[model samples]
Target: MDYNKVKEGISLLLEGLGVDCNDPHFKESPERVARAWTDELCIGLKEETFHLTTFPMTSGDQPNMIILQHIPVKSICAHHLLPFIGEATVAYIPQKSLCGLSKLSRVVDFFARRPQVQEHLTSDIAQYFQHKLNPQGVGVIIKASHLCMEMRGVKHSGLMTTSALLGCFLKNSTVRAEFMALARLQ
Candidate 1:
């Protein structure tokens, strides 16, 4: 990432808005904002895709639904360039492999670090697991408060929910219901 260019752009933006960077309080603001964006906010732009570690399922291991609930979801909105903060629930029914538990949360963080819409984030996470594990089903749910909606558009604040379901999560009602129950969306 060209940190200097980002800093320059930020400075230009501030100056365009009539804020002088020479002002003591705002002197370091451009660099600070650039660092915030590069080092933290948009890390998905820099990091490689999360490597999901998998192990074969044993005959004795039951093929049951595995769920990780309330994993932190943080992302910048694609349209407004603001942030959406929430938690995500990722669940899947194993076919023959199990993903490393921590990798599930990593998946959420991996996809959520980019500028994205909640619906796309949910679907992408589900697709990653479904493609990686070849799971019998994958379901993802995100409940978030978008700063775009809450702070700007209508000035309302509430968690907006979105979901993506695949495989049996879409084809089987019983499976879907159980997954939804786990997400508290039933």
Candidate 2:
């Protein structure tokens, strides 16, 4: 993250908008906003934050769907740079391995900290587990309230939902339905 560059850019932006950057209330705003963006909003762009660990499943264990729901997500909108706050529901049917339950939340946060569209965010997370864990199936759903929509344009406030299904979740109706039921998307 280029902290200095972001701070300078923000200061110049404020100046260009006729906001006095030297005023006491606004003096440190540029630095603060830059830090907030780098540390909180766009942290997921860093590759180091995406490590997910998986454990081998026993041969005799039944292949089953695992669902993790309502994992909190806060992401910046790629179009507006404003925040979209949401919850993600991720489900996977293990092929030969399973990850820690908490790892699902970490995965959600890792992808959420980047500037993204809800649709892309949904697919990214689903594909990630599908590739890394080689799950039999993966499903991801996100429901968000975008600040750009709530605070700009028509100023309407409503949740936007997006979902992605892969592997068995995409090919098998029964498997997809079970995941949706567990996620309360039915």
Runs in model 2 deviating more than 4 A are none
What is the TM-score of candidate 1? 0.93
TM-score of each: 0.93, 0.94
Clashing pairs in 1: none
Write the residue-wise lDDT of candidate 2 on 1-186 in tens digits: 688898888889889999887799998889898998888788887667467798999878788888988899999899998999989999999999999999999999998888889999999999999999999999999999999999999899999999999999999999988888899953
lDDT of 2: 0.90
Local distance difference test values of all predictions, in order: 0.91, 0.90
| Pairs in clash, predicted candidate 2 | none
RMSD of each: 1.7, 1.6
